[model samples]
Target: MNFELFIARGILSKDKNNFSRPIVRISIISISLGLAVMILSLAITTGFKDAISQKVIGFGSHIKITSFDLNKSFESSPVDMQQPFYPSLADSTGIRHIQVFATKSGLVKSEDQIQGIVMKGIWSDFDRSFFAKNIVEGDLITIDPEKRTNDILISKRIADKLEFNL
Candidate 1:
């Protein structure tokens, strides 16, 4: 009744030189396939977890309080940055920080060159750590809440194509 005991006692031992039994071959193949699948699943899952973690961290914070007009469109509805929950969120536990943001997209034309670009506006409280890490060139200048700023950060690729000199 105990197959494991028989195998352990060498009573049902398999001959290594002779693999003529169909059941033995099938069992070995099945075990190998199972192990391969498990290993592959583990590897893929770990890789996915790592990639998703990096993207979530790299793209900035976990939650964004954008407008409800986000119906699969890039354009977001305008909303007042000041909200009642702002005070509660700041006072609540688990929340690291809160920042305000706005974005608009349009086409820029310069003589013969025309390019589409999206402009993102962030409040003075915005975290610049992510931007700092990704900035290929140019020192990041903080947007003074009161002062008018024309300062903009662009990707190196865009700068080169736009023939930007600074």
Candidate 2:
């Protein structure tokens, strides 16, 4: 029994191309297929993870600065962009760039079409790269601190319903 066990282990571990038994060849083929399947699965899962993460984080940043209020919804008061802690916060480890943003609920009306929409106000400092990558239609709005732009991006569903010209 010991000899047989040693022989079986040696057969599997040998680097030679000539396999003595059909069972050993079958086992090697099975292992190769299993490894290929595992690699394919890993690649597919990683791709999906990256895509979902981009979509989720594209809407908001990892850290948010907001007012301390009981109102949990988006109706909370805005936080002052110029804060005393900004200097320390920027110097802190793991901290990167900071951008000021605001939001207000409003209705967009055009002729006979009226739609309730959440107007997101972003400054020139706001990162547009994320939106540029994930945007399905139209181009990313070029924002300038010195100048204002009329460029607006809306969803196709809204555009279709509103009968938008551009």
Winning model by TM-score:
2
Task: Give the Å shift of residue 62 in candidate 1.
Answer: 2.8
Over the stretch 1-166, how does candidate 2's per-residue lDDT look in tens digits? 6998888777866575565667878887999999999999999999999988877777777788888989866666977767889778878888666788777777778789999887678888877777777677667887877988777777677777888765
Q: How close is candidate 1 to the true structure, as a TM-score?
A: 0.64
The lDDT for every candidate, in the order shown, is 0.76, 0.79
TM-score for every candidate vs. truth? 0.64, 0.65
Q: How close is candidate 2 to the true structure, as a TM-score?
A: 0.65
Off by over 4 Å in 2: 1-24, 106-117, 144-151, 156-165
What lDDT, from 0 to 1, does candidate 2 have?
0.79
State how far residue 7 of model 2 sits from its true place (Å): 5.8
Worst 10 residues of 2 by lDDT: 12-21
lDDT of 1 by residue, 1-50 (tens): 59887664453356544444666668778999999999999999999999
